[model samples]
Target: MLPVEIKSILEKRAKDGWVPEHEAKEILKIAGVPLPKSAFAATRQQALEKAEEIGFPVAAKVVSVKIVHKSDVGGVEINIKDEKSLEKVWERFEKLEAFEGMVIDAMTPGMELFLGARDDEQFGPVVLLGLGGTAVEIYQDIAIRMAPLEKEDVLSMVRELKGARLITGYRGKPSVNLDALAKAVIAFSRLAMDMAGAFSSIDINPLMATPDGCAAVDARIIL
Candidate 1:
């Protein structure tokens, strides 16, 4: 059963055919996917307040249903360590077309990775794991499996990545907890299955994989 909040979001945006980053993250949160502390701010003052509440060194991105690739359009600002920097970002973001507000999140350091799922016409739901961040397409290192993935299936997907060594701790870096990552993946798969027809696709880029666990740093849902 879809949560009332999620159902309401879907119903409201049904005609838009998409969900903004802030709302999409809410859906992922309900599915038990780990996420960085975040809040949506509709004004500069609110952004500052949320940033301070979440603590300094945060990332802010424009929230708009019309905008898909935020970075490409300069709608993203990261490593904001002070209120001044956040205000600057807010000024720039407000100028962008269709700008709604901003989703501010605490900065999380970890190995960048990707988790995504799409409702395939033939396959039903398909989940993907890969090297993420902005270079996801350039690397093209990904593994895919049908929905409702098991623990073993999720582990295998991780192993299949060409950059698998990175996750296992390469060059003396801390190793990410595969068990915890598997839990996140399984939860995401469940979300895919549960929202099968409710959405067209979902993307969790830069799903930060850390020694302790994983977090979805950014996400998108096409309704």
Candidate 2:
């Protein structure tokens, strides 16, 4: 969950129309995200400079309050190898209708999943896990349960889905860190309760699962 201190950073950046390098960091500073170093910069120029300083092949994304699907609206730009790509992508990004602002940071490789939290009328805050990307809409293979579910429950959620086999080192791919994903799910559960006043729902699609850990690639918060 976002600490009271870093929550201010979230408010500060988004208010100034600057997207924080890591929204999750702002939301998870107290508990801490696995890789906070990758989180930095609040604007395209800021991110570009940081990327140049960090070196090539970084990623950039629009931090829009209005657009729930940033990719569909053409607000996401990735594998940005150099300053030249940033220049081109930035221009295209500016033209996006839902562009409130953007975030830029170092790129990391991993598998992807959808993690969501919402305050269900009957259940209060509930967490969801599923196969993400184009398959999320097509397959609808989801598992849902009440907030503060146990680690075993997280495993149960994964096992319950037919796509759960993907995380089990499928097709010669390495198995993912389901434990870390569970922690993130728990963290978001805490966040839902903590920020109940500021938000009504959240969707963290494409939560990247890497050898080191999980990272949220995209997220949406509805107030």
Candidate 3:
């Protein structure tokens, strides 16, 4: 079942027809997907407190319903290790249009992966997996499957990727936990099935795949 808070966020954002990143993360958490510790703050003091609570060396992004490409608008800051830097980033984000708040979250380290779903007239909901990061567009290495995937389907999809070798340890890099990744994929597929027809598209980009598990570090839901 969808959490009441998540349902409320979806409903409110539906008026605008899109769920902001922070709210999208909250909804994904319900699917048992891992996420970095995070908090939302609407004021400078609140941002500082939340940042402190979340710890040093964190990242911050603007939480605006109107702002889609946050980085383009200078609404994102990373490697924030002290109150001074956090304060500065907060001030910068406050300058953006429709500035709602800031999301302060831990800096999760790992190899990036992508997971997404979109409503398809013929397929119902289609799930996508790929090598994620700023280069996802450049690389264009991805695989797809229909929603509600079984374990075998998920495994096959992963192996089909051009970057599949990366997950099994490439060169000196350690292999990521495939079991954990599989679980995350299954959870995302279930979420797609459950929320089918409600969203035009859902994107979980750069799902940080660490030695332990994958974390949905960023997300978006278009209604």
TM-score of 2: 0.82
lDDT of 1: 0.92
Clashes of each: 0, 1, 0
Best by lDDT: 1
Residues 138-198, candidate 2, lDDT per residue (tens digit)? 8888899888777888889989988888876788887788778778777677767676545
Report residue 118 deviation for candidate 3 (angstroms). 0.6
Off by over 4 Å in 2: 6-25, 28-44, 98-100
Q: Rate the local accuracy (lDDT) of all candidates.
A: 0.92, 0.68, 0.86
Candidates sorted by TM-score, descending order? 1, 3, 2
Cα distance off (Å), candidate 2, residue 18: 15
Candidate 1: tens digits of C-alpha lDDT, residues 1-223:
7789889888898988888889999999999999999999998899999999999999999987789999999999899999999999999999998889999999998999999999999999899999999989999999999999999998899889999999988888878999999999999999899888898999999899999988998999988
Query: RMSD for each model, in Å, please?
Result: 0.9, 3.5, 1.3
What shift in Å separates residue 137 of candidate 2 from its native position after superposition? Answer: 2.0
- Residue 69's lDDT within candidate 1 is 95
Ranking by lDDT: 1, 3, 2
